[model samples]
Target: MKFNRQKREEIITSKKKETWGQEIKRNWQLYLMLALPFIYIVVFKYYPMVGAQIAFRKYVPAFGIWGSKWVGLYQFERMFSHPIFWKALKNTITLSTYTLLLSIPIPIVLAICFEYARGKFFRKSVQMSAFLPHFLSTVILVSLINLLFDNRTGVFIHIIQNIFGAKVNVLGDAKFFRHLYVWSGIWQGAGWSSILYISALSGVDTQIHEAAIIDGANKWRRIWHIDLPSIRPTIAIMTIMSMGSILSVGFDKTYMMQNPINYDYSEVLATLEFSMGTAGSVPDYSFAAAIGLAVSVVSFVMVMITNKISKTLSDNSLW
Candidate 1:
């Protein structure tokens, strides 16, 4: 009986190995193409996971990552006690929430408009104009923003001042920072973001539209009943993904747009990490790492929660 079982196991193992060999042999070129990306993820993404250990250590430059003394959660304790960390965390969440709330619907609306528009030429023109700004680098975008809102030279500032005989510094005012950041990002990314929805809309069954038309459904009714239902899954998925990053605001744009006057409202976690780790006289590498780790943990938890909620409510989730 033992010999019979062993023989059966051997046959199964041999078959599995043979199947793997056949797969590799048949798709050797495809495996070769995958090699670079595999190496890239190993080198760039997974490898850096080892360095995350610094968050739990006293990361002295002399001691190095591995050689650094283990400090448990000392850095995290310091971060929790730091006023700037809380401020930065608060600002980061606030900005991200505002951007998410304000920017999420614009792309959907624009994509729907594009799908429903009668004039192909006008749609293309509008799409090109909306997409053009996304290509601008963060530096150039910030510079353009400054030029457009500068207290003295900004066209909008000039017009407002001329019309109302009042001075306004939109960039300098902390009250306006969130609005500027969110709206500028909307302007830059709305068209690009809508492309996915547009593609989804295009794939909608033409037969459904034809049936709706035959049933005396107007364009608005078709959009309401047919178009939106078709893209509801996409919308739910996009929104779930967005909710996952409720703490991550891009550093470059925030940093470039940030000034002393707006720091109270604009100093997000990413910029704070940059400032804490590199900008000071004595860099607090461990503390910065702890903050980064905290942010990552929070983001992961949020993603999980968002995915769970989405799955429960809509049966659509990243997982």
Candidate 2:
């Protein structure tokens, strides 16, 4: 069969194009599945990003985002010189660090306990009780805390005075604010967070455990060798993600719990931003934006650094 070279090449290219088109058509449902998420991202995420320009502008509500006067890095410069900004930044870091240290390991420990629980009913009940607080609104949680720890006629104070003839002001003190916030966060979130680890643990191969048992490995040995190895990837991934989000401590709870007495210790970037938004004769849009941008940039850098470290150390990373 004699074939023209140019015609053969054209035919080959045409066949490739048809194959590609058919593959796309076959996966049309997948494309459709992504449509809603794509639309959501475009509408809620990307669309709002247009206003990020306000970070660079002296935003005026009357003039709108585009009409605002450009102020360059004037806000950023001012932020660097502001003492309150540094204080807020430091507070944010300290709170985040405390929360990370206290909160991250708790879910893992809970997952291990739940996995080892003798009775399914007991385990489920415990899990349900533990997870209940996570569903509570920050306002409700704070109110509950306040009620329990109120300096006057509080349940905790009453118990302390009755049992030990001592009165302790739990909420009014600055020293206890971070502890309260972090411990409450842990209590609320640990069980919910353990759900992922529990799922990962469930997916671990039972055959491996059986094999370890056959080898006469003890329970702790089996867990250390088989279970730990199986879940290490999940742990690494969660650790990296947790580290990346270390700066993003619970803003709602912190803001709600903060009072003038505890402001010295409790004031974080989010609360500072809130104060900046509501303070003065007019809104300090530039200052707020600068503060926000600085936070976002730091968070991004932290995530990148965490990912890099995770990749280097464990060969597991978000990227």
Candidate 3:
């Protein structure tokens, strides 16, 4: 029995090696195809991690990354104490929250509405129009927004003033910046975002809908009882992911939208990091790195917390 067991173990080890060798030999081209992406990730994503230590060091160009003196958490301590840092943190959270409220639900609602639309041509046209904005470059989108909301010459303001006889500077006001940013983003992304939920909706059983209809269910009833429940898992997953990034408002559009007047409301972590890292005569790379690391840590913690809550409340989570 011992001799047979030892022989079986040897045979299993040899077979495992043989199977691995055969797999490599047979799928050489497929492995080669994967190599490009592997190399790209290693170079662009993983390699940069080595530089993250700059957050702890007083990075100087003359001394290089390795030669820089370590300051431990001095940069983070300074960041936490700075008033502008707090302002940036607050604006980031507020804008992201506004964005979450405005942007996430509209897509789901639009997708459901589209599912109920009877006119194929109208639905297709509306979908096309909604999707076209998503393809627009950031520069063009910001430019178009500026043109539409220009206090002195905008067509929208012109119509409003001519009709009501009151001039309003929507673009210049800090209060209106978040509204414009969030709503415009919703308009651009709603249709594209709806594609996923619509796909989920399509998978819902038509037989269930037929049964509900036979039982005297109305359109709203079917939507409420059938459609919404069918897509609740998708909504939960999307919500969790969005909550995870509650602080990472994009820099390009926000930066472009920012002016001296709206800086207080529009300033966020990304823009603040850019300002700290390179905007002044003397760049503080360590300080910027500390802020960036803080944002990442906070985002990660949010994901973990949200995932835990989602699992406890609804039994749905990314993990």
Candidate 4:
């Protein structure tokens, strides 16, 4: 009788909801695991935001960040009025849009291909080959591009001359800048990018695919109806991420690939930021900071807008 009473009380206690603090205490190990990331974010991400004030201040190195004169939006006004700024902005948008447009679908298709591929060894070898290029540094990749596309001794140059009856400066030509940039990026990143989709696809229930098979669904129909819907949320998330970075292209490869002839087409916000920030004897740190801040603001706004649209159109969103 006493044991029965104790069992009843234990059952009641187990049914009771945990308070926030109590739950944290119970899952302290998980919370402990999160502490490092929380600290890192606060230190590296949030802390530097204080220095973003340099964008508004005429940041004289002699006077330091805070001691410098606060000129409000003068830096932004200067940036906006510059023709080079406009050119850089246009190039940045064009390159990023091309990248984003191709980045999304290619990865999804590649991941699906990897999933449906037969023969374990063949799939692994192909995936490894595709992913290997991702580890190459930007400088090395640029060097390889030079070697393969150089106007004089490049292998492709001979083919181009043979086919077109004229020598084309593939490396130095302004017209080829965007093509080389976007396509090389696709080749380098497509496999690495597909990893997330592959992970999401792997988690999909096999029973669902089997059931579809039983219902007379061909591979195409099954992929269209089953695999796609299962991974729709992942696709939505990737789309939002790509839209968020629509203005922020990387610096190293673009800078390395850029030469005098292609500067007009290749100049982007990051390269512009570098040139503005370190422009010889009298570097305009304030203007550079302003440009950086502007890019970050635009990126953030893109993420928010994309997230809202995603939420409205579908059930998946970052929030």
Worst 10 residues of 3 by lDDT: 14-23
Encode model 1's per-residue lDDT on 83-144: one tens digit a residue.
Answer: 89889989998989888987688889999999887898998998899889889899988898
Model 1: lDDT to the true structure: 0.89
lDDT of 2: 0.83
List per-candidate RMSD values in Å: 6.0, 5.6, 5.2, 4.0
Whole-model Cα lDDT of every candidate shown, in order: 0.89, 0.83, 0.89, 0.92
Model 1: lDDT of residue 194: 92
lDDT of 2 by residue, 43-138 (tens): 998876677778888888899889989989887888888888788888888989988887677887798888888899999999899889889999
Candidate 4 C-alpha lDDT tens digits along 39-62: 999999987788889999998888
Candidate 3 Cα misplacement greater than 4 A, ranges: 1-23
Query: Per-residue lDDT of 7-97 in model 3, one digit per residue for the tens?
Result: 9999889777777778889789999999999999999988767788899998988998889999899888999998899999999999899
| Residue 265 lDDT (model 2) | 88
In model 4, which runs have C-alpha deviations exceeding 4 angstroms?
Answer: 1-40, 162-166
Quote the lDDT for 4 in model 1.
100
Residue 29 of model 1 has an lDDT of 100
| TM-score of structure candidate 2 | 0.87
What value does the lDDT take at residue 52 in candidate 2? 70
